[model samples]
Target: QIIEAIESAFGDGPLSGRHVIVTSGPTHEPIDPVRYIANRSSGRQGAEIARALRDLGARVTFVTGPSTTPPPAGVEVVAVETALQMLGAVQGALPADAVICAAAVADWRVANAHADKLKKDPSGRIPTLEFVENPDILATISQMQEDRPRLVVGFAAETSDVLAHARAKRARKGCDWIVANDVSPETGIMGGNENAVLLITADGVEQWPRMEKSEVARRLARRIAEALAE
Candidate 1:
């Protein structure tokens, strides 16, 4: 509701005339026709981020994975299921001012996925599955030599040593900033309403308090606007 009110009052906000691309949710890599690899992402954060960006008057192209949370108003939503399809959708919406890679994309996919569901073996012989690495969307965009967005933000959902992992990921992926959070089962953040995150940048790291995802989105959008303004 707060976001809705903000949207109504919004006119030529900070991000006016700017283009932003946001990737959200969990990419499903099919293991077969029925089975697939995915995470516990609800896509609430991504939706809120898109809404906040739209509230600021930026044109947002939201590339979302399979998720239950609905996309917010006033944004172009491109629905995709696999990591490869998400990459294609993002590339198609290129030449943006910023790209927020908030999606929890699967790292590996079933290389030799069966065409049909495999029936259970009578002798209890389990079938073996092959795995392959998915494309690194964040690194690809960050290292792009031409038409790269001015700002690229990535998310690191870690179980332990969150800061260290996030810092390493930022250096490795070459993104402008990284939002790291502990998604351990105890934290209940994987599909929860709140998030506690650390913002890691080239300058330094700042710890943000646990808050509703909507508030986090609003804060993040404002920061993005500020960074792009400079």
Candidate 2:
């Protein structure tokens, strides 16, 4: 109790005494000893968000996948590869003030991962791959009855009808907000530097101008601070 009090007092910022968890990057679902299914998420935005939350004096726990971008400094980093592992990490860091699910988790994983790489057949027959759905981490956490965060945020990367999809996602996932963005090839938003996002909440949707991912992180962090204050 004394340690907790001292830590909270010394935190000394707008978000002091608050804990935030952010998940970033794409999960790799193994297909074989050498192959895996993954996505193109750069994890830049999530890393920036973690930094922004930390700057606001929040104790940040960053649960991440195999991202090329380095994890942010001054935060507890839990590195994971599969969706299940990521979910476990997030659950372990729970009882947080806020939770952000920014990861591009693979929808399915190999139902029967091979222990060894299969050799090519002389008859040119291809191997049949079976898949199973992965756990919906965002939905699981958002709908938790116990130890649920006050604010739960999710990301919806869409190519068409972004806002509509995001709204449906927020409702389906039961999260407080959804950060929706276009990843259509022309936009160059995915795996790029800048992002234009729509913040969807029960109140309404707010469209943000295209800007650096870091800037978006800062703005979102400020908004989170304001919301938590209220």
Candidate 3:
């Protein structure tokens, strides 16, 4: 640990010369020019993860969605709004050593969003919206055969059966690991500073204790370094 810390301080850590792509924040699916659909993500965890990776001397490509949280220093930031844009950005920054799909990308988008602001009818008639499924960023990168990253990490934000859902997700997405977290309202994790996550890998599932989001990022970053070193 001490040696690794010193190497990291000198910017020659295990992850030096490695490039990692981290997607953070929540992608918005537009319903109209003035309205959109989004998740309850504050981008806190993702930001911290990017920061941690940077501290380990890796070249970080921070692809982010619409969030107020400022990205960390010593990282390249690609700001995007919708899922499609985010997907493009990630693809453009490809061939990385690792990719962390930490963004809460919307599952669907409006297929026929109006160009102008939607007007409210005095007769109280609701406007209908056509929906289309958004691109599965995690699965796309995870299943890539030509230039797949050495490590692919995805996040599963579940309200119930966290581990079961996470394990299934890892297999389904074909990612190297899954970081599962309970974001049920009572947990206060969605927009909070602390988190409790489950690390699901081929070996087994490891449940992490609740702690500050920053600490979780640090631990995950270290693990990624070790994995890459091997």
Off by over 4 Å in 3: 1-11
In model 2, which runs have C-alpha deviations exceeding 4 angstroms? 1-11
Give the per-residue lDDT digits (tens) of candidate 2, residues 120-216.
9899999988999999999999999988898999999999999899999999999999999999999998899999999998899999999999999
Worst 10 residues of 2 by lDDT: 1-10
Q: Please state the error at residue 153 of candidate 3 in Å.
A: 0.3
Candidate lDDT values, in order: 0.92, 0.91, 0.94
Off by over 4 Å in 1: 1-11
TM for candidate 3 is: 0.95
Clashes (backbone N, CA, C under 3 Å), per candidate, total 0, 0, 0
Whole-model alpha-carbon lDDT for candidate 3: 0.94
- Local accuracy of candidate 3 as per-residue lDDT tens digits, 1-230: 75376466556876888999999999988888789999999999999999999988889999999998899999999999999999999999988999999999999999999999999889999899889999999999999989899999999999999999999999999999999999999999999999999999999999899999999999999999888877
Ranked by lDDT from best down, the candidates are: 3, 1, 2
> Residue 119 of model 1: what lDDT?
80
Question: What is the alpha-carbon lDDT of model 2 when measured against the actual structure?
Answer: 0.91
Query: Over the stretch 132-156, how does candidate 1's per-residue lDDT look in tens digits?
Result: 9999999989998998999999999
Q: List the residue pairs that clash in candidate 1.
A: none
